[model samples]
Target: MRISRRLRPRSLRTRLVLIATVLATSAVLVCQAAGLTVMRSWLTDQIDERLTDFRPPSPVYRDVADGNGLDHRARTDDVLPSDYRVFFYGANGRLLSESLGRSDGEPRLPHTAAALKLWNGRPTTVPAETGDGSWRVVADSGSDGMRAVVALPLDTVEGATSKLLWFSLAIGTVVAAAVMVLGSVAVRLGLRPLNRVEDTARRITHGELALSVTETSPDTEVGRLGIAFNTMLDQLRAALHRKDAFERRLRRFMADAGHELRTPLTSIQGFSELLLQQPAMAPLQRNEAHELIARNADRMSRLVDDLLMLAQIGDTPAIRRELVDLLSLAADGVTATALRHPDRDIRLVPLADEDTTPGELDVVEALGDPHQLAQVIGNLLANACTHTPSDTRIEVRVGTVRTGPRAGGTDRAGRTSAAGPMTPGIPASVIEVADDGPGLAADDAHQVFERFYRACHTGAVEAQPGSGLGLAIASTIAEAHGGRLELDTGTGEGCTFRLLVPETTAPKGHTR
Candidate 1:
């Protein structure tokens, strides 16, 4: 719920920005301090040097030589302002001469007896006031008892320093603020890739695997992370697809298996009902009930056998490049179906495409497992029959069906097709079992392959019959052999199931 929270906690941009801000602020502080220290020290050194270097004439002679305040003895005025106190002191406790400009009652120099005494013996610094409100005084010993005394103002110098300090502080503050702002921007920019990755990852969860691959690369660590994440998404998508298929098949298998087993149970119940209804009836009535029960039992047994065969076929491998005989598979399927459902018509016609026997005897051939193919055809036929009333037409015709037109994968012979089409250029070696029975519901086209998905609304079943897994099993088998099972929704009246098997150019081989 916290929208302001960071998506990438340890982001590169944030770290770099923080580091830059710290260094920038530190540099500003150091430079400002150094500048202020150097300026203050240099000013202090000049003032002290001036105090030490000044030499004055004798008090009487200095006053007489300069002619009151206009003399060159006031040369210190040219260097500093007249507001400062410039005077001469004797080591013999004599106040030689003083240039007291604008001092009415008392001189700006500290002329108190205690200060003068200290000033005479020791060249000292003291509190003094000149034309300005107040200043500090420095008196230095000179040779021949002519000491120089200079009064420097605390107020003026401090005012200048205070202004300088303020400016420096302002500049430093601005610099620090700028550093922080720029750091934040740079952090966002640098972490932009990570944001992209986050967004792409979010999209991938919504079934957009193609959204994230370009966000990061495998070159840098971040790129590597991106690649790994994308790969994981791909694997997850595949897994989910397989899981859905599995659930669908599982449900169909359970439904069909359960439905197929119902006959025996119903027959058992029916026989029990009859026996109860006619306990003292004729012996013929009992015999007829027994016969009906046996017939139902036989039907149930065959259904179980078919279910088991289909399940077994699903488990077997159907290699794409392996050889198989279409004729033999079709013949066997036809014979089994004819025997199993004697009341219904089942036929298999090996309709060769070219019609002429090329390279001896031209028979339908392809790459597949014979057992799975048998199951595929048998299940298709059985499905057609199950949906139709008895005596409905059901035929499976196999031949060299064409597959092309759409471009696709590279074959060893350099042939390609498009769209990964099952029925590509021409009619693929297809076997279609269609009937005039109640066709598929428009909605059931997609769901017929789903497990246990009986069309309860259609009223097709006396009860839910036929494990829905049959078509699913057949479809899987077909795909394993580079073939596909397609349902032709021929209106809602009937659905035609087509098995498109890829026929190879391999020479005709003898079938045992």
Candidate 2:
């Protein structure tokens, strides 16, 4: 195990090549072993055939000739070769004629007891080793009480097998080397996409999210991974963009809050200082200074209250939801605003034809926090009253919008439609407060709902003093109730603020 670990390659490509080479070598060795076994078996079979075909001289020749007869010598010479040896023995196991002349090193074959016992002309073959080399021998006995044995040397088979083994080793070595080289190249090419992914990851770590991997085929593993990675990068970039936008809004809010607070604080401080330095000033001046200081103090208090309310709204504000009558709420808002500015012309127009009377109750109901919803309406009314002139007409239209209008149309009072058609999914109760005073410019209309944002009326009449958080608060409240507040206004057409809230039916026996 330790040696294997030491030999293991560090790189994946090298490891793949090493594994391929090992498998190939093992296959080659198996095939070579099979071939060698077959070759050895065939060579042994040829030797056995030669041994089976061997014959001895007839016993009749022995009666007419001596031990060194010409016929016996001729028979032995015909059957034996230089590398083959033949021996003859009598039935009693006595010495007889033998081939393998003494001048040829006189190599003898080992006697096999089992083969020697064979008789009846049936030959038996056996393997034996002698001083010269290994050999295959066949022994048989004739009816004349003579036994003959023939042997063939096995050096040729052994030599051929040895040469084949060397040849296979050389071939296997060359093939293994080639596989290693080619396999490494293939692995490197296959893993090239992964390398690209690593490079992209490195760049992303340095905050370069713009870099993306190019996918070659969606079906491949590497291509799918690249696609998923690109999707993740897109999501991360979007999140970062949202964070940046939120940061900008936060900075702006801080600057605006500071500026708004500074105004009231400066006024309060100046007035208080004037009163302190001039203790014996005129009675009228002293009274005026006290009143101014009190007014600035109130302004500062209201500013702080608005800021705190905005902070609360920024959090998840707990809402006490109940069925609310939007039409009744609008009427209350208009009455309250009229009481504040008695000379301002404020009219309440109910879009619901059934809600014709001013005292109609629960004509348009919705589910929300009654108090917050009322506050939303009151803020819109107050904003309209404050921005418009005393004689400029202001209209409060309360209605349940089931479907949108087909085309633009004017109301009985010639006011354009402020709220468009209701959104498709949910029924909504819309309240629009439109004023005929100088409308907000295009830029101001967009920013009117921003915290502490006041429009700059260039070369026009001054707007009423305000903390500029009313519309922002109203918009937040609307959103909390799964609704939205929108604006419809152009430069010369006057401004309209529309609040749409999802409508809900009142429960049985519920009264407002």
Candidate 3:
């Protein structure tokens, strides 16, 4: 086993060639063996027929038989060639006459009683041995009770078989070698694509992801493999890019969080030191310092809480899903905002008749964590109230979207329309918070939902009290419930924050 393993070909091409050669050679050898067997059998059959015909003295043999002495007839060399020998044996197993007399004066047929009885006037072929070689002999007896035997040498058949064997071996060897060489070449060509794949892999391992295998056909094995490999590479590259982006976001978040926290911490520390050092300070000064410390501490605490919430949302948030009435939720958000800013005009427009009544709104439900969804609405309202002037008009529109945006529909001048029929899927609930205030610039509109991103302002209302995470958290919460938060804003026009959440038919107690 060890020796066979050692002799086995290592390369696929070599192994394929070896296998082809072995199978071809085996087939050739089997055919040659069968052919040789058939040829030898045919030749022996011809020799047997000749021997049987000679038993009843042919014309040549009869002519020789007319001679007076048996010796004279046997010695008629013209009648029989050297390859043919004839002999006569008496009933007592003694040699009577001989043609082509023995070299050492010994009888060609072995003297045995069984042999003499077997040859009693019956024609049969048998094998006999002489000093020279083996022979096939047919023996019979004439009316005079003398056994006549005709023999033919086996050398002719053996010589022909030997030549055929050598010729087959030579031809088979040449064919097998040719097959090996040609098979190796074919195998190499077939596996060339795999070699290219290996090279591509090596390049990818070295960080060269742009290289790809050229796929010529999708039906062939190598082509399919190339296509699959390229797809895998594409996925790998995309995953790596996502990883890099996530890391960058993480780093920037840490830096921004640290900076935001440091300000309140500095204020708290300074005010506390001031209060401690001035024991005889006035009551008003002491009260002012205490208030400042408490306010800054509260600010820091809110920042920390928001940071923790963001982290928790980054992981899979434990969302308790249940049926939620989006209109009722929007009404609650608007009520809360009105109480906080009573001077602002906040309008609640019911885009659908179902949103006009509380009972109807209850029927139009969405599946989500109600608390998170409410927080998203509350955050949008708070962002609008904080960014706009005290008298700016804020509108909260609630409706059910039976279909999504049409293929070529436009949203111009704050108006939207559908060009196609409603899609056959779950309906979505949309809530838009639009405010006529100092709207976001084009650049700020895109980065509004990014963590720690803030817009630039240049007036007295520029100082916005925010950690820049409210919109980001709202967007995250919206996505967690399989929804999205979108924004539309233009300079001096207004800003509209649209939140679309897919409505569900789950029972009131459904949880996920």
lDDT (0 to 1) per candidate: 0.61, 0.71, 0.71
State the weakest 10-residue window (summed lDDT) of model 3: 414-423
lDDT of 2 by residue, 264-313 (tens): 78988998888889999999999998898888788889889888877776
Candidate 2 local accuracy as lDDT? 0.71
- The lDDT leader among the candidates is 3
Model 3: colliding residue pairs: none
**Top model by TM-score, which number?**
3
lDDT string for model 3 (199-292, tens) is 8889988988789888646988888999998888889889999999999988998999999999999999999889789999999999999998
Candidate rank order under lDDT: 3, 2, 1
- TM-scores for all candidates? 0.48, 0.72, 0.81
Error of 2 at 96 (Å): 13
Candidates in descending TM-score order: 3, 2, 1
RMSD for each model, in Å, please?
A: 11.4, 6.7, 5.6
lDDT of 1 at 393: 66
